[model samples]
Target: MNKSKWLYFWGLLITVAIIVISCHHLPPSKSSVTIKLSGWGGSPVEQKLLKQVLQDFEVKHPNIKVKYEVISDQYMDVIKTRLIGEAAPDVFYLDALEAPFLMSQNVLEPLDNYITPEFDLADFEENLLNSFKYQKHIYGLPKDYSTLALFYNKKAFSKAGLDSPPNTWNELRSYSQQLTGKLNKYGFGESPELARQAYKIKAYGGKIVDKKGNATFASESGLKGLNLVIDQYQKERTSVLKSDVGASSGSDMFGQGKVSMVIEGNWAIPYLQETFPQIDFATAEVPTINNKKGTMVYTVAYVMNKQTKHKQAAWKLISYLTGKEGMEKWTGKGFALPTRKSVAEKLGYDQDNFRSALVAGVDYATPWQVGKYPAAIANNFDNQFISALLGEQPLNQAMLRAENNANQQIKMME
Candidate 1:
């Protein structure tokens, strides 16, 4: 009796031990899967917050484990080299500006294939979602986005006795003049830099490039958009270039109260809130021009490297981050605006009380889309454009030269 009972208990224990030892071989439905998630590493606060979020994600998906990797400060350089070596992270950050290049290089897996019918992909902002698309196939889904908004100082407005924020270009000019003072605390900022020219370009229906990706916007309407900015500093003299002001950056001037208003993005919120809490400021849509209302949009997407061996796990991480729940949690800290219309609505960003005007701009806003000529147009025009803003060259002539040189560089690259 004792031998048989002891043998039965031993057999049961050995069977359970074997199952535990073979746990790693279990199917994905029952197995724990580890995936690499990488993005721009940040300050201590951000690191802590992100780690907690990752922990929460692990809690929700007990079978899925996230390995958070801080893709260095030189994010693109490191990411591109990893892609070249076929050792890129399963999930990584891809800027909207870089989406066209990465997608065309066969470096990103098309996300449309992984997306399921039940995912509610339509909840995303069309422009942001479209930015990650190539050949009519979406490569990535946007996690968040930011638009250029005019941030105005209330104290400056009160000092000038202005009734409200400018809605029309004419009012902007007049308001700029009235707010400029002898102390060089100018009314406005010269912020239509090459990095943020999309607003002006779209305001006048000027195409930066045609369907075939050519620099077509260096035309009459484009010139008007370009000149409209230069004229503010060159002719009206009501606004000051960032270089002319001691700030060296437009947002800095607004923060320091050196300028009454400046065009900036949502990332500035935390900085402004923490550093310059005393500044009574609010955000509005960029002043309307040419009888058309418009704003500039930029987005960040979660992309998978085409070379990733763990394609299934990679897709799962990407889909999770861009998914409604994940985006709502990731952007819940108010560090960014959600790219999904549903998430934005959930965040109350669609009709937010404080920054409603800026949120109202998502409908008509145009993405900051330029051709993938290695950012030739942007790089070539950046310094020269800033120089033009400094009154170092005639606006028309400087832009013409920029257009010629950029096209030449593009031709050589082709």
Candidate 2:
């Protein structure tokens, strides 16, 4: 048995001991890279859903960590300030309305380099994707989108003896007349904001802004479309604003049975279901105007800060969050609609009873982007539009004044 065998056993034990001690002393695998993500605060349910998504992402990417923060009020202003100071989150939400300005500023990282063929850029709706593109470079990927649809209280419609939602603008007006009560309820709830009425301008071949981004919504064609809104509120008196009806929003007006129909986005779906469960409601595409179907699409994308040190990790987060798998989870509950055609088809939102109308309008819905000076244009239009709606001024006069004022503000900004 002897000295040779004993020496061999001793050497093997020593070798095993050395290997175990070396492994124990070696540094723990590098700590996960923490990437900051920021977005405006949403409803409790929405926040919970997002937390679930982030948790799932962490599980899949063990080497990456997420630090989420909520910018509760004046979200864009806060984001812009942080970005100017080079203190913005690694990834954050950027709305379509603000995309043009941000993309032009060069503060956002171009995502084209990180996009792979497998990412299936073709799968996203071209219209939504185009909103985040500037000079052929993609700056962000839309996380979700919502298109306006006619949400009608079925009970109210039936009581008014209407069989279905209006299919055309004329029918909508007639239906509104029949549904409007002396003072208690309005047939239609109107938002009267530029974002809501931009399509109406285009319906008559009016451009909201010229190629140079100056306001041109006061054109003859634009007045023709806007006049319809003013007439509905003043002439017909069948429509009411949320303020007029003591409601916080058009959705609230409709939900409270103050209005039989309202043009609202998908976000209202969950709200109505939760807050107004007793209301029997359904959705249809916004009624066609001047023989053309139109609606507005609102979307927000996940954008990376150009100054982020962890570019690759940030891209991974963006890809997964906007990708089919993550999107399915995020939009599955119908709080928001998917931007990808593949994901939409998988979720069957296009065929869903409540969401079908919204999905139907995606192809034709005008995106709610008004060039780089949207804030100025929107402010001027809203102020003057309400005047027209209230009969304080003629539609033509109001729009002309708005267009002039908005352009002047734009020049001042420049």
Candidate 3:
């Protein structure tokens, strides 16, 4: 109606238009993507540490969300069932022992294309990295690993007047004899499982599995190494199994003052320290077997699902977890050793008093993987080995029976 009122209305309309135009040029907000990850349950502390690391990842990746699940029982069985049903997590843990079978099944996503130069793939230990490779393609990246080491009770050693750990198998037997009936029930505790004895078999140049995935660890050379175990259990009677002493494991046998020495991994450090705080213990590289160093190494990796809809998000989680920064945090508490060489160096596990011996053995250790048919081989070997230990049958006869049974089972699968 009036000139001044008309001018005010026009100015307000121009101001509103300018504000709308500026808003359109601003950066669009990132769309969020959530991925599921699954792993077996661990100790409370380990779980807390992993949760913290995952939280850190979420903070750095504001657009991504992680849904984590812990399969506490029958982990591999449940994982396999979930995989076939197409309900498996986008990323999950794969142990080296089961990698061969799973990698052959064409269920896993190859990680080579997503890996970049900045990821420093070369920093991983060759043995660990190789475990997840099949037919020239990398299927998984190892998160952590452990190797067997001699765990000795320091007070028991002092009572037996021994100054240091045994350097050879013969010395170990002798030390076992001296330590027995003095400060403990037995001088050495043995874990009769094949996972613990596979290194012994290898020390005599024995092969556990043929290229065809058949069991072949019953040869003369394999028998020779196994005889070392038999002699100590029957003739020397200086070593005993956990079952014989009514203990749960080699660590428990040693912790309960029933044995002076046991072979275990880095996991035993925290367990022993917390569960049996009064017992003082020390670790050393396993005694040389047949004049050569030998031990068993176990490792697990993070693998991707081929059917995943969110490949980039899954890769980000895997890369961050197996990457240097994430690995340092995971292995910082020393529950497990880092699989990456750089992370191991940064954590100084090689220099740690309790873990140094374990780190030294990795160079010569036999990975705890039999073949694609690991269950058949391991189950038969463990059963027969125990029968022989209990004097139910001769060692040679027991091993031959185990070898035949394992091969038969493998043939059935093939």
Error of 1 at 194 (Å): 1.4
Model 2 residue runs over 4 Å out of place are 1-13, 20-31, 182-184
Better of 1 and 3 by TM-score: 3
Candidate 3 residue 2 Cα shift, in angstroms, is 8.6
Candidate 3 lDDT over residue span 1-414, tens digit each: 699999999999999999999999989998899989999989999999999999999998989999999999999999899899998899999999999999999999999999999999999988888899999999999999999999999999999899999999999999999998988989999898999999999998998998988888899999888998899999999999988999999889988999999999988999999999999999999999889899999999999999899999999999999999999998898888998888898888889899989988888889888889899999999999999988999988999999999999988898
Estimate every model's Cα lDDT from 0 to 1: 0.78, 0.93, 0.93
* Model 1 lDDT, residue 194, Cα: 67
TM-score of each: 0.90, 0.95, 0.96
lDDT of 2: 0.93
Worst 10 residues of 3 by lDDT: 341-350
Assess candidate 1 and give its lDDT.
0.78
lDDT of 2 by residue, 1-414 (tens): 799999999999999999999999999996789999999998898999999999999999999999999999999999999999999999999999999998989899999989999999999998899899999999999999999999988888888888899999999999999988833378899999999999999999999999889999999998889889888888889999999979999888888889888999998998899889999999999999999999999999999999999999999999999999999999988889999999999999989999999999988989999999899999999999998888888888998999999999999988
RMSD score of candidate 2 (Å): 2.4
The weakest ten consecutive residues by lDDT in model 2 span 178-187
Candidate 3, which segments miss by more than 4 Å at Cα? Answer: 1-10, 21-28
Model 1's number of clashes is 0
